[model samples]
Target: MKNFIHTFHKKLQLLAAILILSGVLVSFTYEINTSPDPKKDKVLVGVLRYILKNGHYEPKDVNDDFSKAVYTKFIDEMDPVKRYFIKSDIEEFSQYKYKIDDQLKREDLSFYNLVMERFYQRLEESSTYYKEILAQPFDFEKKEQIKMNYDELDFAKNKNELIDSWRKQMKFNVLNRIQVQLEIEEDKVKEDSTYVKRDFATIEIEAREKTLENINDFYERITELDHTDWFSTFVNCMVEQFDPHTTYFAPRIKEQFDINISGKIEGIGARLQEKNDYTKIVELISGGPAWKQGDLEVGDIILKVAQKDEEPVDIVGMRLDDAIKLIKGKKGTEVILTVKKVDNSIQKITIVRDVVELEETFVKSSIAIKDGKKYGIINLPKFYIDFENPDGRNSGSDMEKEIEALKKENIEGLLIDLRNNGGGSLKTAIEIGGLFIDKGPIVQVKYRGNSPSVKKDTDSDMQWDGSLVILVNELSASASEILAAAMQDYKRAVIIGSNQTYGKGTVQNVIPLNKYYNYPDDLGAVKLTIQKFYRINGGSTQLEGVHSDIAMPDKYSYVEIGERDLKNPLAWDKIEKANYEEMDFYKNFDQVVNTSKERISNSEEFTKINEYAIWLKQAQENNSFSLNFEKYIEEEKEHQAEIDRFKDVFKHESNLEFQSPLKELDLVKKDSSLAAKREAWHKNLKKDIYIDEALKVLSELEPKNNKLLAKK
Candidate 1:
């Protein structure tokens, strides 16, 4: 056994060396590019065709260079700085035409080497920057920090120490990855022992030896090697070749997407992410099991999770999915998590598993007042609501209720706040849009089908006939676009905020891999684009998202942060317009628009927005980024100073907090004034900015009409 172990170790070393050598060669050989290369195009097409055919999809024409074109287009859209590759890079990449099989054979080794080099580079860079960043007092004002840690170890501040740390970190990462892959593979083997028939004795012996060798190599490298900085260089080189979205999803990275999307999952109802070696709770969902227990809080690091009557399993450096699987069990099961609090105190807390739901993301309502006029505000955190489960509280229903409430209050206008709404259900969107207008077309959707289908506002009645406004930003997407487009087309509401919508009009269907392959049913699901949606007015909310009527300034102005900015995104096109009529009340839109422009131009808020827009534009143009510690600190301070300028002017309070608009209406004396107030309140109830201006215009028009009536 000892001899065999020695031999295995020797083989692994050889394999590792071969991988590193191949990766170095490949890195130097391939140059990233955008222009057409027939050879590269052919290779891309072949790979895509294979994926399509073998990957459970109908094979399209693989002969064409469509895949390469799509990839190039996608990359061009995503790279804000355009630093990944230049035209020269494309020209260089066009020279290579390697076979897929040959690439696959050395792919693992190449990837490992590339990653190792990248890791080392980042370690050195981070270490140098860390020392500089720590020299200054921590900037407490900025919400985010670029660097998390710094060290000033006098005795161990040498190249060896840095190398050792880097190696240790890499080994930890590699082991975690191997463990996760093994577990997934093992599950597959157990489900169908026939295909994965393993000789247990041989497997056990081989695995034990490999594990020991991995540990030994990791330890030896950390203690012995003179580490070189290579992370940034390697990552840039690799990512440049690959499409922007095709990133390395490390074992701990599963939670990153979860953080951005759902915020909370069923397991303990806590948000988790890897910070250094620890899986820390970024947030605890309110009213969840974790919050109910009152033991966990944001920034608490979870070290282990133990099942009832089982030994506590150390989860540090474990794959996020595996850890989550252990933590999350059947509802009603008890699981105890050993947690390290922010202050470094450790404690064990038992939490009962329950259906943990995120309530904070649900639609909320308020009222905004400007120039002594009330505007109903419906703040939708996300375009979300479970459609599969009928019992779920639909966002559409919630929005309808808010509209009704505003109507009851008799608001002068309404604003639908979808600033950070990252989209949810399409069904809910249709239902919500149905609340505004009488029976008409809401949005048209076209699949890879023969014809397009027009989804209409089929609801029996309208909730409010008042003026409407939609407040959107770059994050407003998918279902949010559906509602916004519907209102825009019908002229039921004026769209406000941001340059354009998120442009994610396409729909994706989650395809279960286990279902497709009749093998051991443990493989995960794949989300694939299945359909695209078009506005009632033929134009697609695709690459070019729906443009806003009244654009507002934002920090992300220059960042191109939208679905259209994503890699491999579909193109924008047009379809047949749906049947719909413009609202008669909004006929005098010219006068309203002019009045709004005049009013907003004089307002402090609008001036601030204009200033912010200019700042963002300037920031985008800034290409000289500093990696030097002192320079970075200076830049950060300058950035903060610029941000602070808007702090005073951005203060707009909710009118709902002061007094109900309903109560205020009761104080009006004269019948004509009371009637005018009612009209203004009704328009405000729709949360429409344009409508508010329109109401003011109407107020001015009313006296003239009264005089005309007296003359008659």
Candidate 2:
């Protein structure tokens, strides 16, 4: 057995206190040959606990109180929907809840092992519950409702109660599938008026069969998991108490994280979100396999996945991450997806997995004509940079080049679209922010022990000082927030978006765990929050992201989708303002914004968007659902009607046209994929209500004798 005992370089007094506090210095060692592999995991746990204790920016005391907190988090994470583990299970596990902290300090696995055994046993028992309930068709006439938010309900008292709970959940799924099947039949009858409709019992039986398949697939996958899997979950539950972003990634997870950072993923390249036991496609990376296939779409529910020549594996009710793993595979491999489309029609689509280039993530420029004059749009997806080679392709330098090209066209104004941009490199944010002003402090960084350092853009050259508008949304975060805040603070640009951006102010550095200790295999990595960034004006964008100057009514404006929605988020604060000059670039900015607001009030698109926002809020709060099939179908129709009321809002298109860069036009013309993507993007841009309002605001931003200064 090998043990890792890192030599501490702490002060004698601190070391003495740590020893006294811990009582006994216990070290865990892993044998060369072991089945459970507690030795390696114990080392990982030890390393993380030490780092949290000694090196974390805001370390917490690891005692009984912390242990209790971790226990709650683990239980919640293990079964978020409260599907498994009855009341007795909780009582059985209560003995080790407070002892977890002491056990962790001593490298003990008693608590973890006991919890794991109980959880697996409960899951095994619940498997039978689901199968038995699903085998029998649900009673459609029963007037009952299932509480969707399981947190509001207590655990089942006995096996019978647990079976009833699973029964209701299965009934809900069965009702939805039957409703969808009936809707399809109705549509076909509408087309032909002679199509035969299946009886209710037949539909019911098919739905039950599908439910059985989903449960069987779920349990089969669960059986594939090993000790490493559960250990990762437990350790992360412990680490996440410090902050939401600070996470402990297992070796496989760390690899995925690296893949994400590289902006390249070997898969179909579709972003998936789990809602109500179904995995729905949110976004497809342009030019990726799914995008190229053109059959897959956003809002498509992927119900089943199959590899080439293999039977389809049901993904319905499976965890989103697990479902994704089944869908994603090695490059050139084919995966078939059975999806239920938005219109309730089922279809099968096959796509070959490949390393998606994410071409759309790069800085893209287009010319927009509002009257006879041309305006420029620089849509920056992420502040990407090649950190290995600083001088390589990066947002800072690439944006400068894009501006120079736009200047050659003599654009009347410039609009930077940061919507859906979750942020990337910090250095690029400062550089991009510097492009507007001659030179200034862009942001401030506060470390644990060191004083706040002002990250300044020292370049004296200004790229574009013309009319500027920065577009953001609830998803716009970190670097996006920094750039928007800097521009807003300097009075250089009008920030417009949902009510605020995603308020993630903290900075993280991913440390490889193996680097700290010797290990034969990969030991994963720890992403630690070491610092928090602040605006040059001194306010931190922690929870309250930068408020838009012109608050636009968007879909997520009313939802709690920002960093504040996360657990253990850092608190917002302010530091000493950095020394910087504020240019009076938009003296009439307020007036222009007010006029736009008035127009927005009168505009159909804006009004409809606001209505949709209200509807979204109602939908989020409407958790409980009717288990009776008739009521459920009627409720779905009402929901669809409400959506239909606002359907025309998204279809509203501006008359303006977007132009491709002259140099790339020929290349784009030759590449069918690029041409198709550009066409699709231009179509969306025309339909963008926020962009329409942005353009209107730009037209209104006509300066009082060059108030839109051209700084030299």
Candidate 3:
């Protein structure tokens, strides 16, 4: 479920701000005369005057040219594509611009008819082209086969064909989904209902009629679907548009926006992305049905979906919204998906839908020993915890359990592996940070027109008072930033890994607009940027993410990645600091820092990473590589040599048999051999220079208390 806000209220707020700034003695009034051309120039002037007086713009002149400039600017900002109106459409729209003198008014039927007619034509064309493509077997040989080469195609023909194809495919997909749902519902009624008032014939007839009605409803509502790709093209052709951020949400799209913001819904619990005409799996939630089944994997293509014991419906070329509806069902119902694997093999999987609890996203850990030293390795897949379900076990709680297990093992130091962690619950972040430090504010949230709220680590007990090191990369974000920032702020632990974190300091409010309003179908939701997070010292983790205390060589260089490269991202800012005491362990951090630097310089893994980085930089700059058969073979051989050089260090065993680390036979002897093997293995794992450095750092910083106890 998502929180819904009124769209009308949002608009009113803007309008109120404008009115306040104008300071008009009397309310300005003008009547818009209905005409074929509403005098676009006049409307442009009125809008510019209002904006200059009230909006952010402060114009020096108030003339017709100025009005045109404002109108042009609005058009450019609002619509980048000229698609909504071709030259003729623009000319048609310009006829009635004069009607904008007083209140904003337009001939609703005329404007709607113009847009609707164009949309219908596009739909019809899309339907026709889709049918033609469906008539032939889909070719899967080419990875980019579904891509539309618009530049190469005849403009008019291509546009019409593409539109028709899309429409037909969407219609077919919608019809198929309705039929499946109806059948599934019908079966449930037969099984659960006690009363047998109606015969099988009546039930069958009613289900058929219901399915038909659904199909008709979808067809009629096609106009409401604000497919942004189509609108983007339309707006681009119009002229100068506004910032790309400002976009209109169609009724259907509103539902999608809602689902996106909430992050949890009654679906298969899989992350999906649109690739050409297909919805590809970006990632599988660790404990979700897909992951549990072990059939569906990352990069797998969803081809179709089916109801239990029913014919599988092909979903290729179907809209993502429609596909999602088919997959999402009431909890405990089974939905089968037909998936095309990366290996070009196809399989059908049936999943019993359930509430996608966020706790499932976290991975817990224990300890591993090599020689006499205890190594605490907590493998965190993501920083996830479900705030909506307070009673549910969260990532923080799971981590606490792992720490308890490590404490029992008498671990000397800890390794918090945050590799590939995308982040999750903010609440869990604060709680986890509490485990490191005694007490203090963990993170701050700043919202529009509101004082910043400080989230503190209020927990009384510290889980681990020993040495700690956090592992991170470019992928770590949101809650990951929160935990890493807190640890750095308190000087409680050493931050090691990539140059910087993924700077996503803002928080979004997922408002479900449809939940507040009644409509034929789900209206969707909006994910609005309502708040930004700041560190305790006031420095924001915006474009500049948390910088690690000690930097090491990473496969991905700082030059190629991080938040600075992102567009339209919020800028970093600072605020007043809160009171806190720094940890004593970090007082001599410079000594530890210098020692690690010197060690890395002498490290073979670091040297290899530096070489690899140089090679990558050269390749990117040159952009010219040998394609000649002989040269290509030679280049490949050279690449193999680099791989071979690093392979010798790990002493990697190809036919290595699995052994239970839990076995208790001559533990010290078993540990000594494993430790020797790992040291040798470390030399080969050059690709992960950060991990190599982390291990070395841990060895140097090994708790003196544990060492002294062992000697005694």
The candidate scoring highest on TM-score is 2
Q: Candidate 1: deviation at residue 547, Å?
A: 1.3
Ranking by lDDT: 2, 3, 1
- Kindly list the per-residue Cα lDDT of model 2 for residues 357-437, writing each as its tens digit: 756668988888999888888899889999798567998899999998888787888999998777889989999998988
lDDT of the candidates, in the order given: 0.53, 0.79, 0.54
Per-residue lDDT value at 580 in model 2: 80
On lDDT, the candidate that comes out on top is 2
- If both were scored by lDDT, which would come out higher, candidate 2 or candidate 3? 2
Q: Alpha-carbon error at 433 in model 2, in Å?
A: 1.2
- With candidate 1 superimposed using the best TM-score fit, by how many Å does residue 585's alpha carbon deviate from the native? 3.3
Cα RMSD to the true fold for all candidates: 17.6, 13.4, 17.6
Q: Taking the tens digit of each residue's C-alpha lDDT, what string does model 3 give over 314-392?
A: 5654556666788888778888887865433345678888766554455544344434566676767776666678787
**Candidate 2: residue 619 Cα off by (Å):** 1.1
The count of residue-pair clashes in candidate 1 stands at 21
Worst 10 residues of 1 by lDDT: 21-30
